[model samples]
Target: MTQPKVTLVVSPRERFSYTRASLESIYANTDYPFDLVFVDVCSPESVQTYLKATSQSFKILRTDHYLSPNQARNVGLRYVLDHTDSQYVVFIENDVVVKRGWLTRLVNCAAETNASVVGPLTCIGNPAHQVIHNAGGQCYIKTDFKNGQARRRIKQSAYLTGRAVADVRDQLHRTPCDYVEFHCMLVRTDTFAMTGLLDEGMLATREHIDFCFMVAQTGGEIYNEREAVVTTDTLGLASNKAGLMARFGQLKLPDFQWSDLPYFMLRWSDRWDRASLDHLRQKWNLAEDKYFTKRYAGLGSRRHELLIQPIVQYLTFGKGSPWLEKLLISLERPFNNYWFNRYAQRFEQS
Candidate 1:
């Protein structure tokens, strides 16, 4: 009997040491035959030497161009689809490790649920932890008040995060979600061929969100398998951010370019204006600032006379304290009223 085939893609350009362990963990734990694909983008000589010296059997696509995750993914996916007969593609970031049976659960869930995409419960270490790092999530716009600021600023986010609460993680099987982030994802071979690849114009930011939105537009469901687990080193951006900054400085990396705001608005916004940003912030129960910019700096305001008239409702309406108050007003928008759907008509699926 032939074992089922899986193709895994990983890009390692930033951290060399961590990626070595990441590769070892996969080779050590995975139980199935997988065609491992690595896109080498301007990796240092030492890193390249290490990869070449490895005993592991894998294929490497070499390039000098700086391909964002979004672009590199396309290069590898096209290669897999065109050169191999694998029926599944798994995309995992470099700083993560998978344990025994992790791949099994992801494959099993995708098979049983017939989902277009199946992702696992991501924890915070190689041994894994209770705190859920990433799961089934949705795109949301938010506003918040801060010290030394005049007016609230608008931001976009995924609705659920933080230490995985018991209720959210208490599940026997896969669950449906608006979309699943790409930290670790197992997708059907046809998902890309059918729906097309991530938008190159958007670069690395919010491409997963946009991809999920695109999946929804095609009437496909994304599932999160609770049992399948992987471990990550960073929590999106906030948790291990200080360490990340130190790495950037240590590596003497150049400035980083982020394009979540205008790119997302241009892709999904109904108006792509301040009103749309503010309305989306109120519509979605998002909190915190993932990607702040000069344009989103707001009316130069802060938390003062909040109860006073003209206060930003966002002050009390987010994933923070004052649960009852936030919950009551949060229901103003119906649950099924996904803002992405409004743009489904104009958004390009293919």
Candidate 2:
């Protein structure tokens, strides 16, 4: 039996430090025959060197300027669409590690069920396969009328988020779903013709939801293949930290090296988040409501917690006083703005 032709496009999710681990895992776990196209966007020297040395194994496309996750996917998608006869394209992030038989399971699900898109059971943190990030869930637009005005809003949810995979192992199965994350997803290559290139305007968030919405609009089916498991290493943040942060508003900072500061800041910048949300609102004719309001208000939360809080903690001997956090954030805001603007300009010119 001849194997299906597939192309795997790996792009940066947020940081470059996990590049080697992610790439090595792909080669080690995946026995399926497929081509690889890696999008290297302004990664550090070490990452660049590693990709260069491994260039013989796959196609490496590099850019000196930074790009959003969607933009990076578009770069690889365009290349695959133009140069290769791949029947399917899998867009995986640089930090996601796949388990054995992951790619084969996704391909088999798509082939057997005729799903236009297939996503694995994505887990998070250390002991990567034990806890679930998302198994698949609901995504749709809800419309309401107030004061004789129609308003539309995006409604999304992820199933089994934070649940231990061992507890729900029997409940997992292949089923249709409205949304799957970009952490790892497989799409029929020809489906791009109907959905168009991923919206580059989704610079900070909602890119996955937007893409899935487009696919559904075109009458394409999406499925969750529970047997295909993968986990994301979220910058060394323990899995429990996310739960604690959500429930009690506690934060444990991840390991962010100095070299990662610029890209991390730009990727989670308030400016990009606001722009992406605004674009989604307008493009989908969504009305401004509490969803947008909360999103807008929390735009700087990531940078504040991940970047500023760490410095404050270090200086204050682990106290991380609120006042110190505020002061450092004020001091860092200008630099963040300047660097992101400079990178944006470079991206535009490129």
Put down candidate 2 lDDT per residue, 1-350, tens digits, no spaces: 87889999999988888888899999999989989999999899988999999889999999878888999999999999999999999999999999999999999999999899999999988877989988999989999889998889878778899899989989789979999999999999999999999999999898888899999999999999999999996565563243222225444344444677678888888788889999999989998888889898787777776666665665666665888888887887787788878887876887
- In the predicted model 2, the residue pairs found to clash are none
Q: What lDDT does model 2 reach?
A: 0.87
Best by lDDT: 2
Give residue 73's error in model 2 in angstroms: 0.7
Error (Å) of candidate 1 at residue 220 is: 1.6
Alpha-carbon RMSD of each model = 13.7, 4.3
Worst 10 residues of 1 by lDDT: 300-309
Off-target runs (Cα >4 Å) in candidate 2 are 239-255, 316-320, 345-350
